[model samples]
Target: MSTVATAFADSSIMLRRNVKHTLRNPTTMFNAVLFPIVIMLMFVKVFGGAFSVGEHYIDYATPGLLVMAVSYGLGATATAVNDDMTKGIINRFKTMDVSRGAMLTGHVVVTTVRCLVACAAIVGVAFAMGFDPEASALDWLGVLGLFVLLAVGASWLTVAMGLAAKTTESAGLATVPLIMLPFLSSAFVPADTMGAGVKQFAEYQPFTPIIETLRGLLAGHVSQGDAIAAVAWCVGFAVLGYVWALSTFKKRA
Candidate 1:
């Protein structure tokens, strides 16, 4: 078979395995759906009064929580990759006739699907909480595009972590930064409200541009600057991550 055909087959098999694993352990979906909603509710109910930046806290928080969900999902992906490595599954695959890109493509595709499902759940919960998108369908599509790009980049980074981790525990622990980044960005609150140093950092951070781009897209505004920045960050990260992960995987193999 051609390399392309082999890669396609390998990716399909890996995707099927991931889907079955997710179905068997429904907790993965449960956490992906619930954790962000819980955080949204908690923030709105507990700190809404203190941070009265908007009429409805949930409305203001929807985008941030959505991003958080995507970020947190990377941890689960990392853990799974690490487990596969530990069990010699990756090594076995390496010795097969699979294409070199198959492993990375499979994980990235699975992660993208999970990201879409989690984003849909977040939108449902947000709507239930009276959070509405003021943007048109095209704008919403733009936001979804940005999300897919971000997920692909993040999955590569997590794959590298999985390859580099000495243990499963470390692989799981490496995701803390991913989880915390949204909070530190313009996600929960505006950067201007933070201290000067933090605000400066937040303004330039990757997540800030991503969140801004999403918010603008969802709000029906034309934020070209933010849009450009978001795309730049996503593409840059994806390329860098792909290079690093491929190098690491080859070395380890």
Candidate 2:
């Protein structure tokens, strides 16, 4: 096989192995898919009336949860990578004829796929709870596109953190800030409602544009400006994370 073909084959093998591990030890997988749904339900049931979005709280809220669900890849990837590094799995792979970059790519690919599944589950549960979005086919496609971008970007960043961490605990902690970003952004509320300082910070944060874009798309009102900003953020995250992850992995491996 050619170099590209061989690398693809190697990455596929690694991806299958990682997926099997995820199936056997499904705690992380369960959390990745279920945690956001529970949070969404809690918000919809308890705080739905209190929220300023009023009648459309479920419609407005589910997108944020979907974005949050997309972030599961980060924590999962970080833990998996850290475990492999500390548990001598990386060493074992190094001794073999595996493609060096293939292992990292496999983790990234699997995380993206997992995020897709989580996003789908979130949507299904949202429907059951009366969270109906009048989005067109194109709008749905745009939402899917943003999700893929987010999953891949987060996956790379977490992979970098995992490679950098000395232990699995620290690796898991690396995701705290990431998981917290949604709340600080315009996910649950409009950034304009925030005070001056906070509004500025919330508006400029990476998660804000993403949340806004997804919310707008789902509501059948695509804000071109926010969409551009969202795509830019995704691209920036993916590029920085990919470079950082590759460099960190090379040094560690």
Best candidate, lDDT-wise?
2
Candidate 2: worst 10 consecutive residues by lDDT? 47-56
Candidate 2 local lDDT, residue 184:
84
Candidate 1 per-residue lDDT over residues 17-38, each given as its tens digit: 8878776866777666667778
What is the C-alpha local distance difference test score of candidate 2? 0.87
Q: Per-residue lDDT for 253 in model 1?
A: 65
lDDT of each: 0.82, 0.87
lDDT of 2 at 73: 51
TM-score (C-alpha, index-matched) for candidate 2: 0.96
lDDT of 2 by residue, 1-253 (tens): 8999999999999999988977786777877888888888888889878779644888988878988897755787898999998898888998898998898998888888888888999899989888889899999999999989988888888888888999999999998889988888887878888998989999999988899899889989989999999999888888888898888878887
Show pairs that collide, candidate 2. none
